[model samples]
Target chain A: MAHLTPTPVIEPLQDRTMILNMGPQHPSTHGVLRVILEIDGENVVRIMPDIGYLHTGIEKTCEAKFYQQVVPLTDRIDYLCPLTNNLCYALAVEKLLGMEIPPKAQWLRVLLNELTRINSHLVWLGTHALDIGAMTVFLYCFREREDILRIFEMVSGQRMMTSYFRIGGIALEPPLGFFEKVRDFADRFPSRVDEYENLLTGNPIWLMRTKGIARITAEDAIALGATGPTLRGSGVDLDLRRDMPYSGYENFKFKVPLGKEGDVFDRYMCRVAELRESLAIVKQALEGMPEGPIKANMPKVVLPDREKMKTEMEALIYHFKIITEGFSVPAGEVYQAVESPRGEMGYYVVSDGTAKPYRVHMRAACLANLQTLPLMCEGRLIADVVAAIGSIDIVLGEIDR
Target chain B: MALAPPITDLEKLKTHPALASLLDWNPGAIEGVKFDRDEMSIVIDRAHIRDACTLLRDHREFAFEFLSDVTCVDWYPSEPRFEVIYHLLSISKKERVRLKVRLDGSSPVVESITAVWPAANYFEREVFDLFGIRFSGHPYLRRIMMPEDWNGNPLRKDYPVEGYR
Candidate 1:
C-alpha cells in the first residue's frame, strides 16, 4: 500500500538515475519479492527490496495454538527446508521444557536434517543455474531431489510439508527400510554432485556470469548479518553446526566450505561443496545409527503410540490429556539457532509456564541476509541483480513471515 | 540433563562477561540480570541501552560483534508492558548474550541499535510494525509486514486473534 503512493521507496539522488520496478511476479526473484531499483541506463544506482506479499502472520498465530500444533505451521515458513524449520522450533520448545531427546532420535534428526540440506541445495542449484541460463543443471538437480523427497515421504507420509520433528522428540519411529533408502541415495549423491559441477563448475559462460559479479566483502557481509553459505561465501568460517553444535551435530565430522571472493560463483561453489560435506555427514549418520525410542519417554509431554494407547489406560489418559490440554513449559525464554540451508534459522520461544507459548519469534536468516542485497547489487549491472538474488537464496515466505 | 533453576540474582551474574562489562562501564545502567537456559540476559536501563550496546560490541574481552536478532515481547496488563530483546553473538568467541530494555505501557520507545549494526534496520521495522513500539532515530520506520494503512498492531495481547472485521 505504501508503494501505491506517488513517492518512491527510495528517491533518486542524481538526475540521470531513473526508477525501475522489478518483480513481485518476475521469475528471477524466486518468489513474490518486489524490488524497487533506481537505475541509470543499465546500471543499478540503488535497490530496496519490497516484501510482505507472503506474510501469513505465523508468529501471531503460534500464540493461539497448542505447542504441538505449531510444528505444522513452521513447515510453511520455509518450504524449501521444512524439516529445518520444524527442527528449530521443536528444539526451542524442548529447551524451554528441558526435555532430553534420546540418542537414537538425535542421530535420526541429524541424518534427516542433512538430507533436507541436500534436498534444499539441490533445488537452489537447479533453480540458480536455470536463472543463470544453464538448463541441464535444473533437470539433474531435481532428479536427486526427487529421491530425497521420496525418503521424506517414506518417513513422514508427506513430502513437502513434513511436520516430522516433534517437540520432545520425533513424531514417529522412522519406518523400516528408511535407512536403506537414505543409504542408497547417499551412495549415489556424490556422483550427482559431480554431474552438476561438471556442467557449471568448468563452464566458462557460467564463470563469466557469476565470478566477480555482485561481490561483497567479509566485513560488509558480517555487518549486514549475513549467515549460512552467504556469510561462509564471504570467508567468515562460522557454522552453527560446528561452532554451536545442537541436535548431536557435535558428533558429526564435516568441513565447512569457505569462499574468498564473496561473489555469486563463490557462494555457488560453497553450496555445491556443502552438498558433498552434507552427504558425508549423512553417511556417517547411517553407519553409526543408534538404537532406542524415537520419541522421548516423557508421556505427559509426548504422545503415546497407538498400540500403547489402546492397550493401557494410563497411556490413553496421558495421550488424551496431552491432546486436550497441552503440557505446560517453564516460564522463561530460550533462543535456539540452527545452521539451516539458508543461514542461521533461530526460534526464540518464551513461556509463561502455560500450555501456550507467550511469544514465539523466528529470527529468520533471510530477513537479515536480505538487507545485504543493496550492498551487493548497487553500482553493478542490472542483470547482476538476478545473480545476486540467487546467490542469497532467499525464500520470501521466510523473509515475510 | 536435569533442568537447573535460573540464577536471577545480580550479584551471582555480575561475573558474566556481558554483565561484568556493563557493571564496569556503569553499574547504574543495568537494572537486572538473568542466566537461564544456558543463556545470559541483562535488563538494561532504557536510557542507557545504546551506550551499553556500544560497550558490549567494542569491549576487548567480550567482542559481541554480531547482533544476531532484535525482537520484542509484550507483557500486557503490566506496568512495564514491553521488553525489547536484543540477542548479540561474539562470533570469534562462539558466545551469545541477550540485552533487554523494558518500556512502560504509556510510551513504548527505545533507542535503535541500527547505528551499532546496520542489520538492525529491518528487524526494528518489523518490531515497530507488529508491536507498535517506536524505535527512536530509526532512519525509515515504516510498516514492514502489515499494510501501511493497517489499523492496529496485531501482536499485542489486547488485539483479538481474529480481526475487527
Candidate 2:
C-alpha cells in the first residue's frame, strides 16, 4: 500500500529565475489584472503588467451615440466613482455647449462628488485590508459602504452605477428626505473612521506589513503620473479640487492631506485623512444648500421640465425633439479633468457640429498608476507585490476602458 | 465648513505670462491660437512638437510640467484627417493649455514627447492603440487597451463601431 501510494514531487531551480503569473483570475490582483513576475527564490527580479482583459471599447462606442446619451457609458468606466466620470464628461460637453449651470446644481455636485470619494475609499480600504490578512476591518468597511450605497440608490435609483450627473446639472433633485439621511450618515461616519483606525492603526501586524514597504519618491510619483492619494502619499501637494477647481469645489473648505514617507503605510494614512476632509466638505455643502433651479436654463440642450412637459404643448414638443434628435455642439474640442478617488479622470471630447462626438478619449489615472507597479515591485520580496498593487487602489475597468 | 474662492478662472488663465512666452519662443511653430469658453488651445506644426513640448516643460516661466492627456481626433473627408491633441498643466500656476498638431491622413506620424515628460508614455501608447498613429521615438509603442493581436484601430472614422472580423 505504501509503495502503491504516489508522492508529489517538487523541482528546484538553481542559479535561475522562475517565471510566475499572478493573475487574470487571482483574487488579490484586484480586477482582472495579470502580472508576469520573474523571481529568484522569494525575491522578485522583474515584473511586467499585461492589461486589457476588461476593455469594452467604450471610446469607440461614444462616436456612435449622442452627447447626452454618452453619460450612462461613462458610469461604467470607474464603477466606484461613477458621478465623477459623469461630471467630467458633462463639463467637457458643457464647455462646448457654452451653458451656465445653476448655482444649486454646482453646489449639489460638489456635495455628491465628495460622497463618491468616501464611497471609493471605503472599498479600497476593505479590499486592501482583506488582501493584507485583516478580516475584521473588511467587514466593518463594507457596513459603512452599504450606507453610502443606500444614499446613492435613494437619489439616482441605482446603487453603484448612479449616473446622477447630467450635462447641465444633476440627474434629478434628490428626494425630500435625502439631505437629512445624508446628514445622519455624515454625522456617524467620523466615529466609524475612528473605529477603522482603532482596528488597524495599533495592530502591530498591520504596521509590520505596510510600513516602509513599496516605497516611492515624490519625484518618481510625479514622473510616473501617479495622482490622488498615490501622488499625495509621496509628499506632492497637488489636488485638482484645490489647484484647478471645477463645479464649485473652490467654495468648499477642506484640507489636502499629505504623507511624507511615500510608503504603503503613508498611502493608507493619506486616504484615512482624506475621508475626514471629504466629510467636512459634505457637511459644509449641506449647511449652505443653495436655493435655485437644479438644472441649467438652456432649453436647447437641457431637457424640458417634467412638470412642464405634461401640460404645455411647447414643452412636450421640445422634450420629444431633444430626446429623439440630440442637440448639436459647435465644432471644437474641450478637455475636462476632475479629481476622482483614484486620481485625475480627464475627458478629451471633440465635437464636429453634430450630435455625435467626433472623438471621446478618457485619461484614466489607474492606467498610469499601474505602470509604476514594475518599478516598485522589482528587487523586493514577492510578498510585497500584493501590497504594492493594493496601495495603487486601481480599478481595472477604468484602466482598460 | 465654509466657502472659499474658486480655484479655476478661464479668463485669468487666458492672460497668463506663460502663454505669452510660448508664443514668443518660436513664432514659426504656432499656426493659430484660440480661446473659447475660457479654454486656451494652440495649434502648432507637427514638425516642432518635440521641441515645443521640451520648451513648455523646461522653461521656467512656462513650466507646464504635467502632460495630463494625449488623444487624437479623426475628421474624415477633411484636409487634415487626424488631429493629435495634448493637454499640459502647470501645477504651480494652476493653469492648463491644449496643444494641437494636425496630421495628414497619409502617414499620421509625429515625434514622441515622452522624452520631455515620462507621463506621456502610456498616453502615447493609448493613442497608438486606438488611432493607428505612430510616435517617432517611443521606447515601446504597442497596443495598450487592445489585445496584442487585434485588427484595426477601432477609433478611426472609417472603422465600423460594430468592428470587423
Candidate 3:
C-alpha cells in the first residue's frame, strides 16, 4: 500500500506587506468600519474596508410593514439627509402607483431637498474637517448648520430624518415664515462657505494633507461605481439631478462644480461649491414657486384633502383607508435614484399589488463610496489614512442598510 | 462633476427568451418571487443564477453594467435559510435588475463574483459576517464587519439576536 503522503507546500513569503488591523471600534473609522490594511512601514500597501457593523435589517423589516409605515424607517438609512431617502423611497412607490404630485408639492420637495443637501454637506464638512485635525472648522460649520436644522424642525417637526417627503407629496404644510428663515440662512451661507475655504484652502498644512492625497482618476471613479462629489472631484460632472433631472431639477439653472486634481482638496472644494449651489437651487425653487395643491389629486393613492375629510364621506373613507390599510400600488418594480448630498441615493422597490413592498432595496451612495477606500488608502502614510477616510464621506447607516 | 448616464430600459428586456421563459416558468417554483405586473423575484437557484444574471447584464438590450450592491437576507426555517441578492445597474440603458440566490439551511455556499467585478469583495465579506454564507473562490475569505473570533453570524434568523453561544 503506497502511503498517501500529503506534502504541505511551504510558500515563500516574499515582498508581501505586513497586515495591520484597523478599527471596528476606533472613533475615526466612521461607525464600526474595520479596515484590514496591508502596510509596508509608514506607507499603506493595500486597504480593504470592512462594513456592516450598523446593519439594522431595515430592508427586511420594511417587507413586514405596510407601505405608509415604511416612511419613518427610511429616515434612519442615511440619518444625515433623511428627507432625501424619504423622497427617493416615495418616488419609487409613486412610479409604481402612477401618481403625479401637484406642482406646489414638487417645488416644496425641491426646496426641502436642496436644504437637506446643504444640511448633509455641512455635517460632511464639519466631521470631515475634524477627522483631518481641524476642530475649529467642525464647530464653525455646525454653527451655520444649526440654522438649517431649525428650518427642518419648522417644516417637519424633526431636526434630522424628517420623513417630510411622502408618497405623493409633503407630510403637511410648513409652519410660519419657513421661506423667510430659509432665505435668511441662504443669505448668510455664502460668506460662511468663504470662511471654510479660507481656513483650509490657503493653509499649507491643510493643502499638504488634502491636495495630493487619495487622488483617483475619473475612469477609476466610474469603474468603482463612485458618484456625487467623489466622482465630480475627478473632473467628471455626473450629477443625477442635472443629467437624470428628477423632481424637475432641469427647470432650474445651476452650475455643477468640477475639479481637475481629484484629491481630498478637490472633493472638499466640490462639496463646498455644492453648498453654494444648493443655496442657489433653494433660492431658485423659492423664486419659481408654483401655486397649486400640495398633494396630488389622486385620492386613491394620495390621502384625501384635509378639509374634505371633515364633511365628505368618500374623503373620510379615503383618509381612513390610506392611513390604516395603506394604498395599493400597481404591481411593478421601479428603481428611483435621487441626487442626495452623498451621491446617487437610489431605491429599488418591487410591489406585488399589495400594501407592502414585495422587496425594498436601497442602492445607497455612501455604501458604494466607501468601497474605494482601499484604492485610496493604499500607498499613503498611516496618518493620512484618517484624511482619506474622511474624504470618502461615508455614513455607516447608509453602508449597513 | 459631470452627469451620470440615465434612463434604464429593462422592462422590455425582461421579455428576453431565457428570462422571458422565467416570466411564466412556474412563479411558484421560486419562493421569494412575487408577481403583480411581472415576476419580482427575491430568490433564485444557485445553478442557473449566473445565466440569469448574464441574461440581465450582458444583453445589450438590458445592459446593467454597474454592480451596485450585494446583500444577504436570513430567513430561518423557510427551507432556504438564507437569500443573497445582487443589485445591478445599466448606465447606458438606465435600468436596474436584481439577481437572487437561495441557500438551504444546511451548508450555505455561493460562487464568488470577485473575478467579474472587484466591488463584490467587501460585500461578500459582509454576507459572510452576518449570514455566514461562504463564497467559494473568494481571494481572501474572512470575517468582515466583525472580529475574526465572532461566534455566530449575527444576521442569521436562527442565530439568536443576542449571539449564538
Candidate 4:
C-alpha cells in the first residue's frame, strides 16, 4: 500500500536547493492548479503541476444521463468556450447517429464557433497580460469580451453555459437582427485589436517579460501533446478546421498562423493573429450564409418546432416521447475534433444503442497542453514559470473533468 | 442520407494504410479491423500494442507521429471487459486512426506507449486512474481525477452512478 499514498511530485536534488509550493489558490496559476517547484535561489531545478482539485467527474455523470442531456455537461468542461464544447459534443453524437446537419445549421455553427474562439482568446489575452503585470490590457480585453458575451446571450439565452447546439442541430433559429449585431461587432473588432496591440505588442516591459522566456521546441511540443497556439508557436502548422475541416469549415478561407520561436511571446503573437483569421472566417460565414432549415429532418432525433408540435398530432407524440424517454442512438463510437481557441477540442463518444451514452470522454486540450509546463519551465527562472503557465491557457474544469 | 453498414471483415479492409502496414509487419499482431462511419479502428493484440504503435509512428507512408488521445471503455459481465483505445493523428498527412486493445477483467494490464510518444504519459495515467486498468512501464501510475485513498474504480460498469453510499 506504499503506492496508495501519492508520491511527492519532486525530490530535492541538492542541499542548496529548497522546495516551494505555489497555488491551488494563487491567482497566477489559473484555476486550482498546485505546482510543486524545487528551486535553487531564483533558478527552477524541477517543476511538477498537481491537479484534480476541480474534479467533478463529468464523464461518469454523462454515463447516467440521456444523450441530449449531456450537452449541458459539456458546457461545464471549458467555461471560456462553452459553444465550442457544445459543437464538438453535438458533432460526435450526430456522427454516431449518422445524421446530416442542414447547410444553414453548419454555417451557423461555424459563425458561432469563431465568435467563441474570439471570446476565449480575449479572456486569455487579458488574463495572460494581467499575469505578466500589464493591468490595463486586462480591462481593454474584457471590454471587447463584454460585447462577445452579449452576442452569446443573444443566441443561447444563457451567457456562459450556452448549450445552444443540439445533437441534430442548433437549439433554435437566430432571433431577428442577430446577423446585424454580429456584423456590427465584426466591423468594429479590427481597430480594437490594434488598440490592444498598441498597448503591449511594442511595449518594452511586455517584450522583456515574454520574449525568449519559457521556450519549447516544435519537436518537444508535439511529443508532449501540445496543440493550438502552444504547438503553433513552436512552428507546427496544424489547425483542425483547415486540416480536417469539420462542420463546413472547408468552404471558408483563412490562414493558419505560425510562429518561428517557441516562446511565450510567440504563443501570444500566434493567438493575436488567430483573432484576425477567426474574424475573417466569421465574415465569410455571414456573407455566404445559407438559407434553409436550421436542423436535420429527422423527427425522432430532433425536437419539433413549437408551432408544428401544436398543430400536428405526430409531432406532439414525438415531442412527448423525446422529452420523456429520449431517442436511442445507433450502437457505435465516433471521435469528433474541432479547432477550439486553446487547441484541438475533441469528443470521443461511444453509444450502446440506448437512450444514454455508454461512455463520453472529452479529449481536453488543456490537460495535454498542461503537460508541457515542465518542459518549458524546468530550467528557467522561477518568475518565468508564470509566463509558461499563462502561455498554455489551461482551464481547470476541462483538465479535472 | 442513410447510414452505410460498417465493414468489419479484415480481408475487405486489408488495403487500408494502417492495416496494410500492420499486416506487413506481422499479421498476427492485429486481432480485428473495422471501418465504420468514416473512421477506421483496428483491434491490436494486447501483447503487441506498444510495438504496433511504434511501427505506425515510424512508418513513412502513414506517419502517425502525434498521439491524439487514449481512453478506455469498460464492459462488465464479459470476458474481455476492457477496451483500451488509442487515437493517433498524422500531422503531415492530416489522417487519423484508432487502435484498440482488449483485456480481460481478471488482469486488465497492457504495455504503456509512453516510449513511442511521451504524450501518452497523461492520457495513460488518466485511463489508469478512472478505469482501474494498469499500464505497465508507465512513469507514474497514480489516481488522477480521484483521490489516492478513494475506494474502487468509479467508471467501471458495476460501480453505482451515485457512488457507494
- What are the DockQ scores of the candidates, in order? 0.67, 0.34, 0.16, 0.63
Model 1 agreement with the true structure over A275-307: per-residue lDDT tens digits:
999999999999999888888888899999999
Clashes in each model (backbone N, CA, C under 3 Å)?
0, 0, 11, 0
> lDDT (0-100) at residue A260 of candidate 1?
95
Error of 4 at A47 (Å): 0.5
lDDT of 3 at B17: 40
Tell me the tens digit of each residue's lDDT in model 4 across A65-96.
99999999999999999999999999999998
Instruction: Show where candidate 1 strays beyond 4 Å.
Output: A1-11
- lDDT (0-100) at residue A234 of candidate 2? 91
Ten-residue stretch with the least lDDT total in model 3 chain A: A1-10
Per-residue lDDT of A204-226 in model 3, one digit per residue for the tens?
A: 98988898899888767766778
B122-165: candidate 4 lDDT, tens digit per residue = 89988988899999999888878887777888889999998999
Worst 10 residues of 3 chain B by lDDT: B1-10
Model no. 4, DockQ = 0.63
**TM-score per candidate, in order?**
0.98, 0.93, 0.81, 0.98
| lDDT, candidate 3, at A292 | 77
Taken over the whole model, the C-alpha lDDT of each candidate is 0.92, 0.87, 0.77, 0.93
Off by over 4 Å in 3: A1-21, A38-40, B1-65, B71-87, B90-110, B125-135, B141-165
Model 3 residue A11 distance off true place after TM-score fit, in angstroms: 16
Error of 2 at A70 (Å): 0.6
Candidate 1: clashing pairs of residues:
none
Number of the top-ranking candidate, with lDDT as the measure: 4
